[model samples]
Target: MTSLPKTMHAVAATGSVPLDDERALLDVELPLPELRPRDVLVEVAAVSVNPVDVKTRGRRAADAPPFVLGYDAAGTVVAVGSEVSLFAPGDEVFHAGVITRQGTNAEFHAVDERLVGRKPSTLSMAEAAAMPLTTITAWESLFDRFGLRADSTGTLLALAGAGGVGSILTQLARQLTGVTVITTASRPETQDWSRRMGAHHVVDHHGDLAASVLELAPGGVDRVFTPSTTGRVPLFAEIVRPFGSIVAIDEDPDMDLRVLKGKSIAWLWESMFTRGVYETPDMVGQHDLLNAAADLFDDGTLVTTLTHEISGLDAAGLREAHAIVASGRSIGKVVVAR
Candidate 1:
């Protein structure tokens, strides 16, 4: 067994504080995690920042203990619970852990075996860390929420295509499905990145989204996905074909979902943590999906989207990563590697 430390360093943010406040996140010491029957202990090698982390930090209560806020992680298994069947000590793995549990900003973390998968052998830990959350969300949104099949032939309109989930979503839609994908990218670099990720067409979100998409699809798109909860519900409604599906991961409190009623469009919300958060009967589906994604990576069907990497697992670095994500200008994923 690998020797374990009694305490580990982790970056955490106190709840309900503004994410832009540097004091919100701090480097702290946490006792090593105790594992559950289905858990595996991982010595975290790398972690990535996602919008969920910023949202979670902002929504936490002001008085709450510094909440560790990260989801995507890649590491080597240092220990495992007695009931863990899928992995053992020394296994290299990656996962987007359950939202109800403490996140993966720590040097060590414990995650349920069902929510984890073996890391793709071709990628480094930092590269693998950039994947789990966005990949799972993209996969779930594309196939599960939209009920899209690999043989499906249609056009998909992906909003904010340069963002973390959108980048991967565009790739999966292009490679896995027969869909002609049109991605929204405002900047020159991001537009290039979207095309490199396999988007058949790249449009500008800063301009008239519906008009841009109409020019590409002629009528409208058969599917739409937006990672951020922007007030683009009406735009999506305008460009989505009748009875088409629209999926999103962000919380849209102000969204008027009724607008889609005329076309009978299907509006779906996808949260990657839903399965683990609810302890659903098919929680193991995360394991299966992650393994399938790893296969895609190994076989060259998928690529890691990590464009920026922070060197240390500390509060300062975490805050920098968070700021980049909050800026909405990051082209791909940003990771913190130790």
Candidate 2:
């Protein structure tokens, strides 16, 4: 095996500073990540920014050491731990690193093999980097949380359909299931993007959300998938069919569950990091789903949602990617590639 470097170039959040702060993100040198028994050390080629990166950066303790803040990554595996069975050195792979571990915003990243998948033969590293995290969240929401299947028939209302998870979720629900996908996009560009992602109907979220949805789905949607749940659970209760489910990606601890009591609506949460963080028995499910998604990409059943790309994997590029994702107006995933 070739000798690996002891340290690598990386970008990290210096503190819980605002995005506008120059110290918010800085280039630093980090020791090459230490690998666990089932881990692989990947030479990261590209990374995509997500809401989690911004949230993690903003909430990091000021006193804490500068921390890496990326999750979705595409790279080539350079080494593997003794117990790793799924990948060998030189394998091109992609994965969303677990939140509990050091993140992927570095020249090299250590990730458990069970959470990694072979990169799609059809996608560039930047394109593949835009997928893993959002893809897993969307897949688990539709298949695991809602139990949607190829034969399942219903209407799905995806809030913020032009966003990362929403973009992919719209395609998965439309292509894999019999559901009529209704997505919310207040802007013309996003509406067009939603349609391109396979949404059967696009409703303006800035308007009367419930009214717009009701017009398209007169009986209320069979399922509602929301990226944000604060101030929206009540709206979900109003537009979801009785006994239907609502899956949320964001955390809303104070949300009132009573609002959905009248209709007995089921409320669920999806955190793609759950299985890896807790080392659940189904942790390998991420690998499986990612491989499935890769096949779909290779076969042209799915397409990359990356709409914005930065030229290099440096602090400036990452900051720009973060800014794009933080703008709340980005129509799809934003990536930074080497």
Please give each candidate's TM-score.
0.97, 0.98
Best by lDDT: 2
Query: What are the lDDT scores of the predictions, listed in order?
Result: 0.90, 0.93
Q: Across residues 1-338, which tens digit of lDDT does each residue of candidate 2 receive? A: 78999999999898787787879999999889999999999999999999999988988888888888899999999999999999999999999989988888999999999999999999999999999999999999999999999999989999999999999999999999999999999999999999999999999999999999998888889999989888888898889989999998897888888999999999888999999999999899999999999999999999999998899898889889888888999989999999
For 1-338, candidate 1 gives per-residue lDDT tens digits of: 65798999988888676666776998899999999999999999999999888878877888887778789999999999989899989999999998889999999999999999999999999999999999999999988998889899998888888889988999999899899998889899999999999999999888977788888887788988877656878887788889898888776688898899999999888988899999999999999999999999999999999999999988988988998988878989999999
Q: Give the TM-score of candidate 2.
A: 0.98
Q: What is the lDDT of residue 276 in candidate 2?
A: 96
Give the TM-score (vs. native) of candidate 1.
0.97
List where candidate 2 sits over 4 angstroms from the true fold: none
